[model samples]
Target: MQACANWIDGGPQPSRADQWLDVTNPATGAVIARVPLSTAEEVEQAVQSAERAFADWGCWPPVERARVMFRFQQVLRDHFDELARLIVEDNGKTLAEAKGSVQRGIEVVEFAAGIPSLGMGDVLKDIAPGVDCEMIRQPLGVVAGFTPFNFPVMVPLWMIPIALACGNTFVLKPSERAPLAGLRIAELFAECGAPPGTWNVLHGTARVAEQLMADPRIQAVSVVGSSPIA
Candidate 1:
């Protein structure tokens, strides 16, 4: 069986974990691959990488950040069919459904690419006797995404692009049941020139999710899973 490991600091890192989770083809009931059941220490390492990257990434001008998203969107478009195939192979979804899932993700990347204009802040100058205030959307340091297996591509897409476009470094903990798609997408992000440590992935179960939720460094968390998982 093929084994998949986590993506950390812009590359795949073999897990130090002693345990693994089996990924099964839901339609055929056959085990396809094994993913690491990452330890808290391992998950924390990814978080630390994001934290370290945040100082620079979070300070980058919005236009510069949008440039990265532009390249990311193009790279994703170039691999549209390939990504859909990975989704079907990993999750046992029909090819059509997998393509739809991947397309939905692509749309989010498109929206993120426009963040320089769409996400701009506002200012009311001299509102009250020479006083002015500005409300700007700023990056929250070290954001984390916890996605489920069912919508592997769509769910992570909903979070990662926007977070990165808005200048936040991210740590993703994709569901262990369907880890391949996330790993593959992370590879695309790297190919598009996203800096190391700006985006990271760790594969594991609820234990790792809970650790992420409890960590102080994770300023924001997004979950698109079951009620229990949320």
Candidate 2:
């Protein structure tokens, strides 16, 4: 059942505040679990953690970050079954579709694991007299992502691993309709050697998503949804 009763952070009880949201299995329309809905204040705490993590995380060497991503990808594959189950239960997708969705998400980690290539630098040949020009890819401070219900695991992958590899810490806002799946990824990120505050998760609706985007702490925002919704 994933024990949505708690959110995963550096350890257990990842959420702050008294507000909570119930999770139902869209497939069967049964109450699956209860997830603590993080208030704006609580969300700020996560942003602070991620912001604090950025100073060092932004300086993390590409190869070192790649190592963590490697282990992360392997671990995700190790728990593929569990991840697939949650997707199917929460999304009401056929079990096979859920598994495929998770598989695609796992592949994103793999793609991101090649950080050296993914985090490429730019080169400029002789911008002036005997002066070599170049630009290095660096972290973009704290990035917040709002993942949609269509693909809980997949949407998060679109941001977290890539952003972390680029040395940017993350705050994830998963859809309230199917939120626990994003929280689960936070647990995996920690397990993957993502430093405390390097990644955080919160659940909510448009209000929460807007809160994330509007926060100055979040330097960048990735809103995932269909074109029509936008």
Candidate 3:
């Protein structure tokens, strides 16, 4: 079976833990691959990596960041079908559903590509006689996201692109059961010139979530999962 590893720092790296979780193809009930169940320390490392990257990424000019996002959007569009197929193989969703789901993800990236404008703050001109009031939007450092298995591409795309576009480095912990899609997304981000440590994917079980929630380095945690898991 293929061993799915964590996307740490800037590249694909195997989890330190020997314990593995089986990734099944829901359509065939077959064990297609195995993903490492990362430990708390591994999660911490991922967070630290994000934190380390935050200053540079967060300080990048909005247009530069948007350019990278624009490239990412094009790359996503070019390989949209292959990504949807991976989602289908991993999540066992219908090809049409997978395509639609991945398209929604690409849409979010498209939205993120406009962050230069979308993330702009309003200005109150000449407030109080020569004094101006401005509403400024800032990027939180080292944000984290926990995604579900069902709509892996769509949900995470909703979180990551916007977060990275807003200048926050991201640490994503995708569901172990359908992780290949997320890993591939990380690879594409790098291929499209996204900086390492800016988008990291850590695969694991509940411990990963606990660590994310407890970590000070993770400024925010966004999740898309069932209430039972929430």
Candidate 4:
């Protein structure tokens, strides 16, 4: 069986973990791959990588960041069919549903590509006599996202593009049940010339998510799940 590796820094690395979770094709009972139950140290490494990248990424002009998103959107388009297939395999959704999910994800990327305008701050000039007020938007240091199995591709897309377009680096933990779609997305993002650490994928279980949430380096966390899990 194939073993999935974490995408840390800019590339894939096998986890030093002693345990893993199986990724089965939901349509059949076949085990397609194994994803590491990544160790806390590995989780820390992901957070640190995002933190390091944030220094430069956060300073990039919004237009430049938007340009990256533009490239990513194109890349996603180029591999649209393949992504849909992967989603179907991983999530057992119908081919049409998978395609719809990927399409919605691409739409989010399109929105993110407009961040240069959408993220612009406002200035209230001469509000009072000789006084002016301004509001400026900035990227938070490092952010993490925890996605559920149901919307593997679309959920991660919802978080990643906006965070990166706003100039923040990201670390994502996709659901252990269906990780391939998220892993492939990370790979395609790297291929689109995104700098290392700008976006990363760490595959693991809830323990890994807890580690990420507890870390001080993670400035914000976005999670999708039921109230008990949330």
Q: List clash counts for every candidate, in order.
A: 0, 0, 0, 0
CA lDDT of every candidate: 0.88, 0.78, 0.88, 0.90
Error of 3 at 211 (Å): 0.6
Worst 10 residues of 1 by lDDT: 221-230
Please provide, for model 2 over 3-113, each residue's C-alpha lDDT reduced to its tens digit, 9 standing for 90 to 100.
Answer: 452332365555565666678987678988766666777777777887778887888898899998899888888888888888887878888988898889888888888
Report the lDDT tens digits of candidate 3 across residue range 127-204. 788899999999989988989999888899999999999999999989888999998988899877666799999988
RMSD of each: 1.3, 2.5, 1.4, 1.1
**lDDT by residue for model 1 over 41-110, one digit each (tens)?**
8888899888888888888888888889989888988999998888888888999999999999999998
Clashes of 1: 0
Q: Per-candidate TM vs. native?
A: 0.96, 0.90, 0.95, 0.97
By lDDT, who's the top model here? 4
Number of the top TM-score candidate: 4
State candidate 1's TM-score.
0.96
Select the stronger candidate by TM-score from 2 and 4. Answer: 4
Ranking by TM-score: 4, 1, 3, 2
Better of 3 and 4 by lDDT: 4
